[model samples]
Target: MADTIISNHGSSEKGANPLPANSVIVVLGASGDLAKKKTFPALFGLYRYDLLPKNVKIVGYARSKIEEDDYKKRISAYIKVLDDKVKKQLEEFLSFNTYVSGQYDKDESFQVLTKHIEELEAGATEPHRLFYMALPPNVFTVVAQHLKRNSYPKNGGARIIIEKPFGHDLASSRELQTSLEPIWAEDEIFRIDHYLGKEMVKNILILRFGNEFLGASWNKNHISSVQITFKEPFGTEGRGGYFDQFGIIRDVMQNHLLQVLTMIAMERPVSFSAEDIRDEKVRVLRAMPIIDPKNVIIGQYDKSDDGTKPSYLDDETVPKDSRCATFAAIVTYIKNDRWDGVPFVLKAGKALDGAKVEVRVQFKDVTSGIFKDIPRNELVIRIQPSEAVYLKMNTKLPGLTTKTSVTELDLTYKNRFKDLHIPEAYESLILDAINGDHSNFVRDDELDASWKIFTPLLHYLDENTDIIPAKYPYGSRGPAFLDDFLASYGYVREQNGLYNWPHTSANGKL
Candidate 1:
């Protein structure tokens, strides 16, 4: 099958093409929330920016009884076209859109889909196919196997895009790999973890590898500890039934938080190739020691006094007797020479007072100080709510007599870069998938190592009610014991009233 020429309708002058237009992108589970809210919007964005190929087409697949026009209307409603030029470009992009309705588990339906794709690719050169799976974890194996057995393109390049929550545990994840092995080559399968697509997250490599200053101080000898946090202000919002099952560990820490951790902790790769980066990340993940239950804490949201918010157990989806944790904090240790004995603490919670994502690296304190007291040095990488990097070190106070105080070396994205637009995580990840850039995608070994480290804890929580999660009020920082937990490890709560350590050492002591 050659590349298909669905339409030559969009303008081509906005930016360099990210992918050839003739590439055919097939999105599975097209009627789901992810497809409507994220997948299509990202494709439309690429089209609007002229990053798509001239003859590209998008094939939406699901079991919905929806017409092509209705699909277009739904996509239009969700796509954020801010200007007249973008709106016109989107209309042109829509001209190349098509939809297929079918049962994902049925071979006959997949064969029909394959036939339709062949028909769409009637006449063109360099035909490429990207199969995107935006469905639930349970269906990933079924869909991947079905595509392998029935729908893979016979000619041109073929790639399969899979969403996260890859497996419930290590064994299941490996099982998934076995199921996908026959149908897709390792290189052709992309396991997307969207956090890698965030603008700040991408900058981690650049900040460490591209700059000589930060690179010099990014090891165990100079740094004391690393902290990664993902806080959500809103509760499960009546979705606890689904959320409670996975909790914070599997839902956030396993994939999103670990991706950030590996990017920060892994050794610099020789090249920017996906394989090289993933190789480095796998090394870091595999080197991480098993987390002791004593160093881990879990929490749930309690009922609020205001009576306006629903508790986790009150959600229609969650069982009244559910002991699922809504918050989790782990003090992980990486056994590698670079990070041995250094704590890599990860904390995530829903229904917290505020939402924030950041990485704080606290440097070892200066051994000797000529001044009466010396302040510790620190580096903070902010990922969300604001995207920026800041360095905290001691400096002389203005118009003061021998007075020094801690200050920040601020590099705020909004303040420094005017008119710069940060693309959404889904948009970036989608584009990377289309272009076959797997640097941000999760590899099989990495997934296995991640599960191996956390699965025991998950199982422990499931079997023992004595280790039941604590409950905190909504709009609160988290469980009251969060401070005690950190303090036990020689970490002190910061003056900002958050559970964080100073980025730099004060007076040369860690």
Candidate 2:
């Protein structure tokens, strides 16, 4: 892929085309925390790696009129600079940045932005433009329309990157896609769901299709259940106002975990191209039926027993009688020939025991008369905190006794890729945007298919305000009924021993 595209240093390779010399990346909502923490830091990472074209300009657009020095300070605060050389690179990256204050809906503001970009690209050839919308959903379409109408490059190409929470439900999601698809071509719009860029998430395909052993047991005949979990230890500290509008389901389970589930359950694509991969994903999602509320469990966090952490209601920004769920566990089934009757459980929560995200694929138990009640095999792919791929299997005890133990064949990236720098999810996505690689980005039909599976449950949860959620103390794993919920779906839990991979047995870390 690197050889296919020219680097920002203006390389003259056989098949690589030099990046537009006059490219400009404009960061909308530049005064917000997303821009400062994620968008700008990602841009800086690209610049430091020499992946961004030389002489390309970066513009910051927002409604706030902060001082240029202050704006620069906020955005660079999150960039990690190891030494003086990287420090100087950060200084140089900041040099190309300039700020402009503008309203999202007004055309005059976009015109001003266009004029500034034109002035910056006065003498350079192929003045390409990229607009990054770091703003709230309410302003997404308005800003996109204005950018297309007023600031769209005439002689060069233009691309726009938009973030997730595309909409609250299926109807709204379709509306969002309908409104924007007309203004921007499908190829030019980059719908970003940052989870797709995670290192382990990207490796799922290689882990499944590249390895015959794992791929062989990836169907209903060999697998019992699949669980995708996202847990966060801390609640929304001060962003309750935004978080309350869309609870844990919309925040994590609906998009992020569901995306992971699709990757796990989809059939192998014909090719590794963007459309082929996404086509397979859409097929799997279309086979999945709308989630049943009966198979769903919603919970709200109460104050911890230690009383150190705050509950959902304790947040001043949240409504006192809010029925919003802070945690959710949903069961969905794909009625395809490959995964028929197998349960796929997606769970997400805030203020849980710890922060972790992983997919646990539990294989069916051994059908034998030799050993009494043995635990089933499980393949675990840890997506974050500590990236690893471990397969839990039964092994004989060292002694000459007819005993068995559960151990894992592990692949921790930290031990294996010791010299490799694992790029942040944002860094990977931004680089893909620069290279025009749409493989990691979301497509319109993908969004529609995903929403179709969750919209009915969302509507039920919204209408039934009188129904109270299960209360779990902050920092605990989850509600008491969580185990029962899993059991209902024929999910078995190991009751014998503490299972710790990579750190347990000697030579297991490999």
Q: Tens digit of lDDT per residue, candidate 2, span 357-413?
A: 999999988997887778889989999888999988888757778677678788888
Query: Which regions of candidate 1 fall more than 4 Å away from where they truly are?
Result: 1-21, 124-126, 368-375, 495-510
Error of 2 at 183 (Å): 1.0
Q: Each model's TM-score, in the order given?
A: 0.91, 0.94
What's the lDDT for candidate 2?
0.87
Question: lDDT of each structure?
Answer: 0.82, 0.87
Q: 421 in model 1: Cα distance from truth in Å?
A: 2.5
